[model samples]
Target: MNPPDNPSANRWLVTACLAQVQAMRYTPAGLPALDMVLEHESQQHEGGGERLARASIKAVAFGPLAERLARQALGSCWNFRGFLAAGRGGKGLVFHIQDMQNT
Candidate 1:
């Protein structure tokens, strides 16, 4: 089956620590951008079983979000709301962060 052009359920919100943060950059459009890695570790119930889930995902933020994230220290915890998408010319998933807040 063919998929929708823009899937509505591709959203992801994870409260994770900033494992790493790269220097900020600007897109060709002159929008501020920052790249970072988020680490999430928690216990979750899956298939009626308890499991310890740990994940590390690459994330990018733009505009004001990028400016805000740039000042955050590594290892700081925040609740990030974003969507999943393929990395730029890379493999696996990359989180496109839109909003974030301290937890």
Candidate 2:
């Protein structure tokens, strides 16, 4: 038996506080675009003990979602649903947010 290739597991979701929101911009295609950093902190059980997990990730949203996100205040918490992908110019990872809601 061979393992099947499955990329559907690339989905990512997290609840985090928004910070450093850039001014709304338009893409070459004229779609609204927004970029920002997300700060996440939570406690999780690890090694039978509680541990704090913290991270800061780069995130971007486009189109109507971007327009909506642009209106959100910094430091606001949101539940973000997205997928990870290599950032433009193939540098590091970027969270391409598909949808989000206030947390």
Candidate 3:
């Protein structure tokens, strides 16, 4: 299916720490793939109250990004630019990372 005409509509930018990383694997097409978890914690104002927001999200990167992420140290923080999509079997959302930079 074709993507939406407005690319920014689905884009997601998150700043979080790398919580865990699995062994690098290859797709059937031989492209490198990496799966990992990212942890985010911050304080935000909601409903006129201060709230602590914490999240742990499942994420994946493909090809060169995957390879590069594999070499990064766990617990490192980064600014991740990506998009979200349903995972295999139409399960929960998975963040498909497109680019990242140290934070």
Candidate 4:
């Protein structure tokens, strides 16, 4: 399968998303304020194992407005980026931008 491109590949986009997400202060509302290249990081342990790893999570805002915006942004980069929730402990959401054209 081919990876998707990042909507927030541009610094401006990332900054905009980050700022908006933070300003919104609500996951549902904040989600739309960001570009599609945004991903939430989550940390967890494996079953019966003393190992730690990151996991990718497909996130969707719990509201119609947010979901619509998120979907719109994500759709643009769906072919170049993977929505992953950081498995490692972190303070906030991490946006990983990929160069789909290069890949």
For model 1, the superposed segments whose C-alpha errors exceed 4 Å read: 1-7
Query: Residue 91's C-alpha lDDT in candidate 4?
Result: 44
Q: Could you give candidate 4's per-residue lDDT for residues 1-103 as a string of tens digits?
A: 4544975333312112211222222454353332333332334467865554433432223334343444343323232332333422754554443322211
**Model 2 spans > 4 angstroms off:** 1-7
Which residue pairs of candidate 1 clash?
A: none
Best by lDDT: 3
| lDDT tens readout by residue for model 2, 4-73 | 4875677899999887788898889899999899999999999999999999999999999989888888
Model 2: which ten-residue window has the lowest total lDDT? 1-10
- What TM-score goes with each of the models? 0.89, 0.89, 0.93, 0.20
lDDT comparing candidate 3 with the true structure: 0.96
Q: lDDT per prediction?
A: 0.92, 0.91, 0.96, 0.34
| Candidate 3: residue 25 lDDT (0-100) | 92
Q: In model 3, which residue pairs have backbone atoms overlapping below 3 Å?
A: none
Off by over 4 Å in 4: 1-48, 62-103
Comparing 2 with 3 on TM-score, the higher-scoring candidate is: 3
Q: How many residue pairs in model 3 have overlapping backbones?
A: 0
Q: Give the TM-score of candidate 1.
A: 0.89
Over 1-103, each residue of candidate 3 has an lDDT whose tens digit, in order, gives: 8978997999999999999999999999999999999999989999999999999999999999999999999999999999999998999999999999988
